[model samples]
Target: MKTRKLTAADAEAYWELRLLALQDHPDAFSTSYEDAIKQEDPIGRVKGNLESPDAETYGIFKEGKIAGNATLRYETPVKLRHRADLVGVYLAPEIRGKGYGKMLITKMFQAARGRDGIEKINLAVADTNPAARHVYEQAGFKPFGVEEKALKMGDTYISEIHMTLVLEDDK
Candidate 1:
């Protein structure tokens, strides 16, 4: 498997994988596949995001196809600029249980650390996804709080555990 930061040229593959992730695990994400598919110029938006300086999206490839991805997005507000949010984390089912998820997360950490003034990385994982939570814990993220009814699908509500990892300066 090969891992690297994704660029605007990889937008299509990333978007396709994102849709698959939303469809396969509706409870694992806050955005519904239906809602995501309805967005206008979705690919263009994704391309713009990929090209943005405030965010870095990492991808893991298996046999030259993107099998998983994660993104670290820095806060834009001046006072909040020292923090980043880890979002859009997803790995294909075929690639799970093989450490790729953690690997992808590690890449995010590296990216965050490489950026100046990024002291912490935050993420939210659905309560139903123990596997993802485990991976986050293994990567040194600690639970900060839980948001109840974070996502509603049909008549079911999914809560989310918010986590944070503070980066140690490599001085």
Candidate 2:
């Protein structure tokens, strides 16, 4: 498998895979497939965000196809410059448990560590998904808090477990 920071050229592939994530695991993400598909020029939007400052999206490829992805975004405010967020993490169900998830996260941490003033990496995982939570914890993320009923999908509500990984010492 190969991994790299996504670019405008990767917009189509990224969007296709992202849609799969939304459709396959509706409760795991905040965005609904209905909402995402309604956006105009979503490919352009994906490209724009990838090129935006203070944020980056990474993708893992298998046999020339995007199989997984994760995004990291840092705050712009001076006071919050030391923190960054990890979001939009997903792996194709067919590719799970082969170390792709961990590999993607490790890449994110490596990228964060290389950035100046980035001291912490924070992420939110659905509380009901212990497998995903285990992956984050095994990667050294500590639970800071839980947001009750963080996501509402139709009639069901899902809690989110907020986690953080301090990178100061690792720096």
The per-model lDDT (C-alpha) reads 0.93, 0.92
- Candidate 2 stretches greater than 4 Å from native: 169-171
lDDT of 1 by residue, 37-154 (tens): 9999999999999999989999999999999999899999999999999998999999999999988987888899899899998999999999999999998999999999999888
Name the 10 consecutive residues with the lowest summed lDDT in model 2.
Answer: 162-171
Per-candidate TM-scores read 0.96, 0.97
Off by over 4 Å in 1: 169-171
What's the C-alpha lDDT at position 124 in model 2?
A: 97
Best by lDDT: 1
- Worst lDDT run of 10 residues, candidate 1, spans 162-171
lDDT of 2 by residue, 23-101 (tens): 9888889999999999999998998998998898999999989999999999999899999999999999988988888
| Residue pairs with clashing backbones, model 1 | none
Candidate 1's error at 56, in angstroms? Answer: 0.7
